[model samples]
Structure formats: C-alpha cells, structure tokens
Target: MDLFSGTTFKRAVAAAVALPLAGGATLVAAGPAAADEEDYKILVVGKTLGFRHSHIDDTTRALIDLGEDNGFTVDVWDPPNDSAGWWGSGSPGQPDLTMDSTPFTSAEDLSQYATLVFVSPVDNTNSLNPATPRLLDDTELAALQGYVHGGGGFVGLHAATDTMHTVPWYGELTGGGARFASHPQQQTATMRVESPAHPSTAHLPAVWERFDEWYNYTTNPRADVHVLLTLDESTYSPGNNAMGEDHPISWCQNFEGGRSWYEGAGHTDASWTDPLFLEHVLKGVEWTAGVVEGGGNCVTFPEVDAVVAGLNTSAVGDGVIAGAIASLLGSARTAAEAGDPATAVQVLGGARSLVDHLSAAAGDRDLLASKIDDLVDWQTGLVDDGPALDLAAEAELRTMGGKQYLAVRVLNEDDAAVDITVTTPYGSKEFAAVAPTKNAYQAFATRLVEVPAGEVTVTATAVLDGETVTEEVAVAYAGTA
Candidate 1:
C-alpha cells in the first residue's frame, strides 16, 4: 500500500467546469485543432498503488497549467484498486476518470512521455494483500531507469520521497528514502538558502515562511547533491529525522545520466496555488525538463538583510565590538558555505546592531567589522568581494596556521606575501612581516585553518617603507568546537 489512499470525487464541481472548458469551448472555438494542442509532453504519474486525491488533484491542475503555458502535454496515470481509488468522471462532469492510464503495467506505456513526475505514492505501508503492488515494481522500474539513463528528466514534488521507500534503487536515485519521523502536524516555518549560486533559487526569497506538512527524510544524501533550499530549525520544531543542524527542503542532483530534483514542501492545497511557492515548483520543473541551464541559490534579500541588520545590532559601534563582529562575520560566511544558513544567520543576526552603530561612529574597528560582514556575505554567494577599496581602512586580525598559510593577491597583479597579525581572545601574536616593495592590488587567500574551539581575530596592515597605506581588514575566526 502506498503512503496515502486516493479518494474518489464522485461529484466534484471542478470536474463539471473542466469538461466544458476542455472541450474547446473556452476560447470560443478558436484556431486550428492541432495548433491549439499543448507543446511539451509531461507524464503525471498519479496514485496507482499509494494514491492521494488531494495531492493528485492539486498537482495535476498545476502541471496542466504549466504545460499549457510552456507547451507540454500532460498525461495523468491513475489506476484504481479496491484499497485505493481514482477520481474523475467517465464523462466531462462525472466523478470517475473517463480513462485509466496505467503506465506502470508496461514499459511501452511509460515511454509515451519525455518527463515523469512523481506525485507521492508507491507501495502500501499498511497492506492486507499477500503480494504487494508497488508503483515501480517490475515493469515501471525498468522503464524509468531506461528513461533517465537515456537522458530523460525526473521531477519529484512534495511527497515524492514519501513514496518508493521500499526500493533501494529508487532511494538512491532520489538521494533519500521516506521516513516520516518528525513533521509539523501544522505548518509555520522559515525555509532558508544554504547555496545561493544555484539557478532555481536566484529569485527565491532567503527565508520562505509558509504552512505545510514538512517531511523529515530518513537520510539526507545531499552533501554531494546540489542543494537549492534548506529548512531553518529556529522557524519550526525539529522532528524525528536525525540529520544535520541545517535540513534541506529542495535540491537537484545528477543521477546516472539523468537530472532529478525533489522539493518536500508541498503537502497542503494552499501550497499548490501560492504564487511564490508555485513559482518555485515551476522553476524546478523547468530545470528538470532541460528547459533551464542552471538554478540560482536560494539566497534572498531577506536573509541578507537579516544578516545586515544582525551585524548592525550587535558589534558595529564600539572598536572592540567591531573587531568581534568582523570575526563573527567570517565564521558566519564559513557556516553559510558549510550549508548552515541558520547558523550563519544566527551569527550575523546576533551582531548586526553593534556593527551598525559602530559604522555610524566611524570607528576604525567598527568599520572593519562592517566590511568583514559585507565580504563574508559576498563570498558565501560567490559575489564580488572587492567593493570600494579603502586604502585608509585599518583593522587588526589574527591568523593561526601550521602548514597551510595565507596569501594576498591584488587585482590584475601577481600574488604577494601578506604580513598579518593574530590576536587571541587572551593576547596577541606578531608574525614576520613580508612587505611588498611596489604597489599592486592584493587580496587574501588561506587554506582551511584548524584552531581550538574559541574566537580569534586576524588583522592585516599594508606597510610601505614604514608608512601605512590601506586600512587594516580584521576577520574573526571560530575554531571547531
């Protein structure tokens, strides 16, 4: 049995409306019959074994609209059984489907479309029958494997992971298996972006707050997968899924020779219609169908604003606070890259106020921290780090390295050795200063540093023959805890 049982809408009002509209009466009978046909071909594999009416109905309508707009043919595969049922009238206004399209029964049937959309159910978790009927049992699995391996695209929406948990290949293909360990019975949480450079998320807001059943998967095989969006725990209750600190809500991965994407936030009817949420799904679908080249990361103005605000509030006013905030911003950037936006936001939010006030004060320390925050945010999103180059800028930061060390590179010039100073929370240490004889642009680079789990500051000052040129840039470092 599939995760959800389908319900028959024997007398649904939508069915009545759809009949007349689909019969060529909507446009007042315009254009040639073939010219009016939709373009893209999509297969919406509805509930066959584990079916849900609401899920199918909502997603089906959305896909239909997308197909019409994007020129795709939508074929819904809905098969009926005694335990689970299909909804659609035999005619235009009826409640039962006019036809039964069971693509899972044969490979030939499944090959009719270019892309296959999985909308929830696979097998029954609670079954009474001796022989279980799975969506990708014998025939459908082979067809799907061939389709994707042959370059066919796959899209999974909302409860896609909720299905096909029993199949190892399916689990590997989707990057995880079903485990409804802890999900919010009601919805209210923020979805943040851990990766901001991916294509689908370029336009998405940093934190997506909505109501829906959030699924916590058994395993998150997303370290290597391209993560588009992540769930922030501070926004909702952490459920049963024992995963990392930051959880993934949407992601795309390359499977075999095919592309696949899964989004786990569409369990409600409202989600299907919300313009923002719907837009996200549309982007994902287009990406999977090979219509789009790359997806932007899920970074939004809100998250960035939040970080900015956080820095202003915490450590931007006082010189000491400024120095601390700069270090914090560095740590936040590291956390963001490590797929922990919550931690990144937390670190930034905690220090925003201080940094803002310090910047107003025009204190060198405060300005330095503010600058660090900007650089960190840019680095996390793969944006430009060099803004207005402040030659008058001055900051003091610490660098701790054993084998791997820091190097500085100026714009349009060769790499130059940088003279840096390290300051522990307790004291300070000075390293041998390697001064450049001539003027060329310079930037900093360093390998991953392993330090004790504590806060440290790194400051760099450019000196030319005992005279200071550029202001110091201070960066905070938080060692592994």
Candidate 2:
C-alpha cells in the first residue's frame, strides 16, 4: 500500500469509513472548536526587503473584501504595510470576518491559516533597510519549508517567485522548477487560457488582452506544473528574457505534501479592482485551501484522463510506473462506480507521480513522478466529491424567479448500485438502478417564497449491501442559489 515502495509504483491501499463533504453552500467543513483554531483564516505575508509595491494595501483590502463575501477571514502579516498588519483606519470593518494583525513568527504561526499568501514579497537578500534583518531568515525559510512539506496551502502572487530566490528549492517550489528572470515594460499583452475548467481561469476569455506587467522565467514550468494560463510572446515584447513559444504565466502544482498556486500577473494597482483578476485570486485561495464551498480542485490529473480516454493497450508495460498508474486509475474508477469513495480516493494517490509524465517507463521512478500524489488524491476525491453531490442523498431549497423550489440530489456512495427513493413532506422521487459514482436529481415547487431560512426533513431509502436501508434527516433549506 506504500505508493513509493520503490523507484516504480506498486499496488494501492484500500479505504475505510468515508464521509465526504457536499458541494455549494451545503458543503460541510470541519470547523474550529475554539477561536484559537482558525482553519478559514488566511495569512497574507507582504513583508518586503526590496522595492515595495504601491498596491500592497489595495491587494490586502481586496482580499479582505473577498474573504468577507466568501467563507474565509483575512489576516495580514506585512511589516512593510503596517508592522501590526491590520488596516485600522482606511478600511471598513467586516463584522462577519476575523481581521487580525498577527505576525508571522514561526512554523506554528503558519498552521493557523487554511493557506498562506505571499503578496509581492521581495527577495530576502535584497535588503532595503540596513537595520532590518530582511524577510524569511534561515529559521523562517526552514519553517516555511516544513509547513509546506506537511500539507499546508501556499499561494504566490506576482513577485512571490522573486522572493526567497537565494535558495534553489524555494525558487523551484515557488515557480515550479523555474526562477523569475526579468520582465519588460508594463503594457497590454494577450493571455491564452490553457485550462478553462480551472477555478482561477474559468472566468477568463480564450484570448485575453490585459494591461499589466508581464514576467518571464528562466526555464519553462510546464514540465513541473499544471499550467492554467500561458502568455503569447507575440502579443508583447518579453524583453531579452523572452520564453518564446511556451511561456507560462499562471499555474498550480502539488508540492511535496501540499498545494501551491502561482500567478505571474497582479502587478498593477488597477488589477485589484478588476473583476476578472479578483475572481481568479479568490478561486486560487479557495482551491489551495482544500476546496471551500463553490470552489474546485486546481490540478487536472492527466494520468486519469488518459486512462478514461483509453490509452493504447500496446502502450502500457505491466511493471512501468505509467502502467501501474493505469491500473490504479482503473481500480479507483471501479471503486467509484461501486460507490466506494474511500477505496477510490486511496487508489488515486498512487498515481500522483504519473500525472503529466508522458515519458515514464517501467521500473523507472522518474523524479517527476513522485511530486503530485496529493493532486491525484484530489482528482479521485472529485470523482464523486464534485460540486453537485458530496454524499449519498440530500435535499436543498433553491430559488428562481422569486419562487421557492425543493431540490433533492442523490449519489451512490456505497459499495454497490441500488434503487434509491428520496421523499420529503412535499413529494417523493424514485431513481431506478442508480449506479456507483452516478447522480440523480429532482426538484419540486414550494410555497416557502416568503419563509425565513430553516431546515426541512428528507427521507432517503436505498438497498445497500443487499439490505434495505433508510435514512431520515432534516436538510437545511436556506442559502441556495
């Protein structure tokens, strides 16, 4: 069951009890029991030892606003903006959010956040203040590394790649095996949407022309990261450091044990107010921080899709890593179709190294293969953990055109397909031969248009494991889109 048993992959472990959370506003989060445990609070580290961006305050304000609307709170840790890190005077207080001026002390401080944001942090070696020791000292850098290696979330904006560039691993981790080299003048350039399905790039156009500072990296990141957006060198002058045909602008990756998302834009102060850019930044935070409500996983497991698309039978070797990934993908899909999300998710972790590995062969552990196992887990989790259904059966109340309607969504989350029947005080709906990893849905009109938000009960019946099973629970009817 050890995925990294050798240079090559082996079989996978099975899953035990599972209770995956649903999608949308109904998505359930393992919340903090006390104020000391803040899972939804994000720490934005804007400490700069070099040139400080003028938009740092604007970015923080925008992030706070976004967090208020979304489900998270924004905490700033920028000594440059405000040693205390809170915008006490200029910004309006958000009552529903937790706005704190916590300092980034150590690795322990990093644990308090769902994700850590590096907003235009300058390189530690570039000290502007002779008295200041600068950012990410040896202790701080080690802390950041350990935090990321232990399943933490990291988001880098604009100059984040420029920060911590003295360390090779830090540079690669921040920019996906590439370092920020240089940039040209600020101008309008075209951006190409490489993966429109990604939450950050979903709202973008196929060919987007925007005015901002464009960055060029020393090496291409496509080999290490799942690129979401690419830049067209033809649209603008990339200076002498042009990356030519395949320049990556924005990307996401599964690091050693966590998730990292980076973007090469967000330089101008105007970008903070831009609707497209805000949505991109908001979703990036949501995705890296364990997929909050209404958000989606960032990485696209190419390995899984290859199997689904049916790779040539002659192309796989029984002992190769790619072949093992193929086997694992099949097992996971079978588990999902059999309504065993646990087994499916467990199996998917074995194929993380195989993602984007177009050249991996048998018995060879191409170092690249072991980098994205958590990403594989994420993709597998979405097989049935997608936005629609998070569990077996649930009821929701949706509103459209000033009328209320009851929505019932059902998923096969057991080990076998069955006949599912969902009932409520309003009516009942039946699903015939519902298979595993599949979904069924029905809606009934309701007269609760003027009613306040409340919970309603639903009865779900299904024959699971050769036994007649029935479950009744009160479903929340409020906050449906």
Candidate 3:
C-alpha cells in the first residue's frame, strides 16, 4: 500500500515497520555493527550553506555518544566542505565524523541506511556555481519517499527545519518548513516533557532548560505531528505568535513509512553540554535507528493545571514586552494572593501567550521559555499550587527536652512567610513567623510540642490564606498534668 495515498495507508505504513536509516550515506559512519543483523546503522548527513557549524558538530558528537552507549555503529556523511556553498567554510577537524565521504546523488544512496539525520539545509544551495546548484528535486524526493515509506527513520536538528519550505512536499516530510513566520528573542528556557514513555525521552529530565533558536515554523506541525516537549509561554517571547498556545520545541511522528523526530533546541554550544539534552538527542537517534521503540502520540494542553509552571525570559526589558508580561504576572500573583486559586491558575495559564510573543520578537526562544518556567513556578504555585515541595525534613523528629519538633520549610522562597497556626485542647493559636526567604531554608522552630501531661488533642495548621493547610501530626502524652 502506498503510504502517501490515503490516511489508512499512512497508518498502516507507520505500524508495519520501525525506524530505519536511509539513502547512500550509511557507508561512512563508524561503530561496532550489531550481530549479522546490525540492529542499528545510522547516517548523519551534514551538507548546507550559512548553516551554523557548531550545531552540526555537536549533533554529530551526540550521535557518536548514543552509538557508544547503545551498542551501534554510526556512519557520518561529511561531503566535501567546498560543496557546502558560502556557509561551508567550516573550521578544520570537522567533516571527519565517518569514513565515508561519498557525494550524495540520489534517493537510492539514502535508502541503504536505517535512519537519516539532516544536519544542514539543502534547497537553493549552490557550492560549485551560481547557475548550477545541488537541489532536492523530484527524483530525490521520490527516493526519500520510498526510503521512509519502507519504514526508514528521519531526524532534523536546528536549521534543517529552515530548509525546503518552497517545496511543499519537503516541508511535510520535515513536519515543519523553511523560514519561521516568527523568530522570537533568544533566551534560556525550559523544555517540558509531554511524552515521558517514548524512547527519545525516557531518560530526559522533565524540564530541559537551555539556549537555542526557536523557529516559528512557516508550515506548523500541530495538525499531523506528535508533540513531545513544548516551550511554556509564561516566560518571555514574541507578543503575537503563529504556533498558537502550545509551541512545540521537540516532537516525533511516523511519517511516510518511518518513525521521525526533530528538536528545535540545539542552537548553542552550551546546550550541547547539557547531559540531559545530549541524552534526548541520543535517544532520538537510537529510536530512529530502531534500537529503541515507541514514538510519542500527539498531545494537547487540556486545561490550565496541565501546564508546567516555571520562570523564563519575560523579565528581560523590551519595555512594551516587559510591561505586558509584568501586567500578566502581577495579575496572576494578585489572584493567587486574593485566595483565588482558580483565577490565578487561569491567569498564569494565559501567560503562555506572553512567552510565545516574546520568543518571536526576540529571534531566540530556547532560553526565554526556560526563564519563564522558572518564574511560572513562583507565580503558579500560588499558595503552594506549583510543583510539589519537598519541604518536610527527614521523618525523624528532633528532640528538645521532652518536646518533639518537626522541621518544615517552604519548598520555594516565593512560598515563604505563609501563615501557620497550631490547634490544641487549650485553644487555637496562630504563630507568626516569616518563611525562609531563600530557595531552601531551615525552620527548626517549627516543631511539634507535647501538650502538658494528659492533654487529649493537638492539631497544627499551615495556612496560606484563611484556611488551615499543612498535614496534621498527632502528639500523644503519657503522663498526667
């Protein structure tokens, strides 16, 4: 069945085979080949102009690391740097990822491998002459279509998504297209995982904060792609965005006949250093190579509570942008303080648009979203509504004479100074003590006191507003008063 003919054919094609490297680039990668079967054979294709060299190098290194860890051989394809056009003047020591340096000519060359990683762009790129250029034409597309249709794998990093928008079919193959409709400011921001079970993210940290260029895709992928991780908009970014409420930072899909994944989070050298991010990229490689299974399904933000809260780039000044974000944050904070958890949640949820806006405006978004994630935690956990705090000290109680004191501190500084009250057989008394002002602080004074001998009941309340909050710990006294 032709995978491109109909939706059912596409579904059948997706389920029939796993990720396989494709094309003529497989001979150059280096690694220990699996048994006779060679479970994982990968091809890293790096050939483009004006393409950032750091991203290509980092992605190649990351693939090598994945192969080493997972027991697979990687075939790196570095065509003559001269063929890379104006942007091809890369520093030496690169273009040496693998042993193969064959010039990629057709789709048949690409079909041999199980996975194909496009590190650079290939559209109207000219290396030899201006009139004559190396472009992906009908034959190339047919070959690529066949490779993936036969269960091959695909992965694109950084600018790969920036290529081939003029060719509608190529854009569809990439799940995104050339030239983002919006390019937001670059800032450090968090990438929250939406599909934790997939191989590409099994070990990735729940929140990946790094710096990179978040492209505003010309042809969005939300309709047909399975979003894995997204940029939380509570932080700084473009004011008006085309990606809508949930902006995809990383995702995977069964395209043509193969499992594919692409991440928009690899624009910086520093980002390559993050172990978690490296692992994520590695997992995608592994999954595409069929060493791992399970591509994520499409995910949507159902409600406000589902959005992860964190700090991002909204604080950076752009005057208008900053002012607007401040207004939103102030509103969320006020709502939370006014004992309106629902209202605060909604306000904070809406703040995601702020992040999208700032990212598009700034032309860089990775760090920006990360910054927003940080701030969101402070505001969203309005009165402890954020991610849970490990504020409870060791279960062991500290002994003070005959008194037992249980130490508890706010998980975050923003949650500090909350009202706390203790209830006992004598009467209900509220203790006024400011919460620790730092991210983590010790409150040794907050302990459980044994009621004077023979007291029947003891209760403690930790309050954020009008009601008692903390868990109740009962203290039983043995002796008579």
Candidate 4:
C-alpha cells in the first residue's frame, strides 16, 4: 500500500531492493531515517548596544552546549563586529571581541536560522558617549518584522526587553508593549509557574525559588500574552512595587504568525549553568524551533485600533455627565500615551463605573449608557486590571512555625485616617486607624494574616470617611498549616 501518492513509485522500488547475500542469506533493510534525526539551526544574537552582561559568554556557551546535546547547530552573533565601526569601544587594551561578523541585513539572511535568541541587548544607556551604534538598523528591523510575521521563532532573555526601544516594530516582534521599567536588588524570590504544563516550565516546581534580578515590568503583559511564570511580589522586596500584585516575570505567545518566548531570569552568570534554568531555556528554544506544540496568539492590530477609536468616540457628547466622562477619558488617554496602558485600563474601569452611576443623571440614559459600555468593553479588552482602588498597598508572604501568613503593608496617600480591611481566601480581618504620617503624604499600616498552604488571593480595602477603595493581590504559600 502507498502511504503517499507522490512517493509511491520511490517506495515500490525501495521495497523491491532486497537481494540475497554472497553466503546465500537474505538481507533485511531498515526504514528511512526519522525527521528528528535532522539537525535544527539556531541563531544566538548577543549584541548589546548598551549595558552588556558579564554572562554573555557563558550564555553563549550554554546555548552551544544545549545545541550539541540536542540535535541542533548554534551560530552565535555578536553585535560590535557585525556592524564594524557602527559599534566599538573607545577604551584601550580592549580585545575588541566579536562573534561571527556576518550581518543579518535582510529577511533572506534571517531565514537560514530556525530561531533567534537575544541575550541582554541594550542600547543608548551610556550617556557619556552618545554615538553608540544600534544593533538593528531600519532595513534589518523590517526584515525581523517580516520574518516573525512569516512564521519565524524568537526567544528573548534578560535585557532583550531593554533593547530596540527606538524601533516600535522590534518591540512588537519581541512582545513589546510592556517594556522593562526597573528591577529590585538581586535577591531570592519565589516564582509561581503560571503554566506548569508548558514545556518550558513542566519540570519546574509549582513555586520556584531563585536568586536573580527580579524585573518589575512597566505594565503587565498578562492581557497580551500567555504568562508562563510570575514573580510573587510578597516573596521578595520589590524596590519600586509599581506593578502591584500581579507581576509576570516570563511569558510566551504565538505572535502574528511566529512563535515568541521571553524569560527575565538570566541576569546573572550562574543562571546559564543551572540545570533547571538551562533546561527551561532549551525547552523554549525547542518550542520556537517547532519541536514542541504550545504558545498563545495575540489580538490583531486592527482590533486594538478599533478599540482605541471607540474610546475616543465614547468620550464625546454634551452634558454634565458627558463632561465627567470626558475628564476620566482624558486621564485614560494620557496614561496610554505615556506608554502605561496598564494604568490607562485601570482608569478606564473607573470611568466605566462613573458612567454606570450616571444612569439617572443622563438625559438619555439608555443611549449614553450603551455608548459608554461599548467604549469600556473595547478598551478593557486590551488591558487587564484588578478592582479599581485609589490607595496602593504592598503584601509580603511570610512563614513561621510551619504556618503561612501574609504581612501586608498599606500605604495611604490621603490625609484622613482610613479603615483598612484585609481579606484572604481563608478569612477576613480589618485594621482600623491607618493614618498618614506628620507632614507627609504617605502613611503606613501593617497587618499579618494566617493563610492556608497554597496559592491565595488577598484583598485589601480602605474606607476613607465614607468612600471605599479595594485592591486584591495574589500570593503563593508553601507551608504545612
């Protein structure tokens, strides 16, 4: 029987090729080699136009080892030599190190490799010398866009999120929207595996404790991509705590027509040598290389534009209600324009609630409410937010005597004393008299609550005079009681 139409004749001939040996023994033949036997080609691009990592060489070695151990070929691309005078150091006694000076100038040049891995590519960080060359030019950026949209694969590590800021297309290719804002000091923190079934995280524990620079992204990409790992803010001290509770440390997405995976875990040199971390990276590479089957696609660009238009349209009209809606809409628009879509989404949620309250105030409640709903729905779809709350609070996970507890620190910017209520999945507790410090706009209040061992969502509510503000944060607990 013929398995395939085009290969029937070839199969028939091969089947009839059996012959007797010189010793009068019949020879048995084996089938064709499997597809896995073929070697996969990978391109490791570690070209930093800004702050370079000391572990770049180690990362390259780890990737080379991963390729050798697996059935793949690794080609490391360093930036300085590829662009020549476009990138170089002014210091003396510098070896002027370069790895494979071949430039990726076009889509054709990029097509030869199955996937591209970026290791801490930074640009324009050195203010002393403003003439630092960028890693990707206009044409090359266009090529990368075309490549990813044409079903290429991309894996970004550490400062890959920090690179190619000037090029919007590059950002979109490497899951751009949410850029690196800041990172706390290198400390040990627990990471919750959002997608344990994912090949990149299947071997990881439910809660992974690792030491590295935990990045606090400017905005949460959870609304845009499939988050694979999230840093438990309560597990470690977050310097800025800008992202609040839901902080995504690593995520993957099937962007456009290509596969994209990014992990913010490789800031230190030891990360490249860790078996678990290396395995995680190797699995990401394999997935991008089409060796594995998983990842998420993003919302279409046209859909996002349509939502933005709706937001603009809903902000129009004439009335006191309209003026209030317009004011809130203006705030949302400013946040989005300032490259903080997360805040914009949160503000829009407040705007939606204000519109809801205007049902009795609006002259045409039905018509105006419908328009407002459409706008809120469209805008909210592009970004994710928790409950709308004015005050910000920090929740820290703690354990003592085998009992898991949450040490929540509340910050109130309001002048009046606010009554705070902290609720855990296990139970709820209230803290009274959270007052601002003397002559300071910030106030601090601390609360400790016992929680069951597992992942739990903690909600903090603050009542000022009469108005109530609520915010919820999730924390992972790995304790006995």
lDDT over C-alpha atoms for residue 133 of model 3 = 41
Off by over 4 Å in 1: 1-38, 51-53, 84-99, 104-112, 126-131, 177-182, 242-244, 296-381, 384-481
What tens digits encode model 1's per-residue C-alpha lDDT throughout 19-101? 22111112111111122334456677666455463656777788788778765767776555455433332212112531354
- Candidate 3 TM-score over all chains jointly: 0.51
- Could you give candidate 4's per-residue lDDT for residues 267-372 as a string of tens digits? 8899988999998898888777666542112222222333333332242342455566667777876775575655765776666666555434234455444444
User: How many clashing pairs does model 2 include?
Assistant: 3
Per-residue accuracy of model 3 over 1-481 as CA lDDT, tens digit each: 2211211101111111222211111222221222245456777776553444566777778777777776655787554444444545542435456445452445556656767888755444322243444345556667777777766778888766665555566666667443345557777666787655566665666777666666666555665666678876665564446465677877776565566788876777776777877777877776665555432222222212122222233446544554565566668657755767456556756665665656454434554444344334333322333322113211122456765433322222235344434343433444454364432222233333542332212222345445444433333333222
| Model 2 misplaced regions, further than 4 Å | 1-39, 81-102, 124-134, 293-296, 300-481
lDDT (10s digit) by residue, model 2, range 1-481: 3211112211111122121321222232321112333347887877665666667677889998998888678777664233222223222222233335434456666766778888887644433344454467777777777777767788899988776655677776775667667889999999997655456765677799999999888789876677778999998898978999999999887676677889889999999999999988887787677654322244444433433344333445433545666677778657755767567667776665354554443223443343234333333333432212124445556666778777666656655555656666567777777777776678777666554554444344555445565554445554432
Q: lDDT (0-100) at residue 195 of candidate 2? A: 53
Query: What TM-score, computed on C-alpha atoms, does each candidate reach?
Result: 0.52, 0.55, 0.51, 0.52
Candidates 2 and 3 compared: the better one by lDDT is: 2
Q: Give the lDDT of residue 470 in candidate 3.
A: 44
Candidate 4 RMSD to the correct structure = 21.7
Candidates 3 and 4, the one with greater lDDT: 4
What is the Cα-based lDDT of residue 196 in candidate 2? 54
lDDT for predicted candidate 2 compared with the true structure = 0.63
Q: What is every candidate's alpha-carbon RMSD to the true fold?
A: 24.9, 15.8, 18.3, 21.7
| Model 1, position 151: C-alpha lDDT score | 63
**CA shift of 472, model 3, Å:** 20
lDDT of 4 at 312: 29
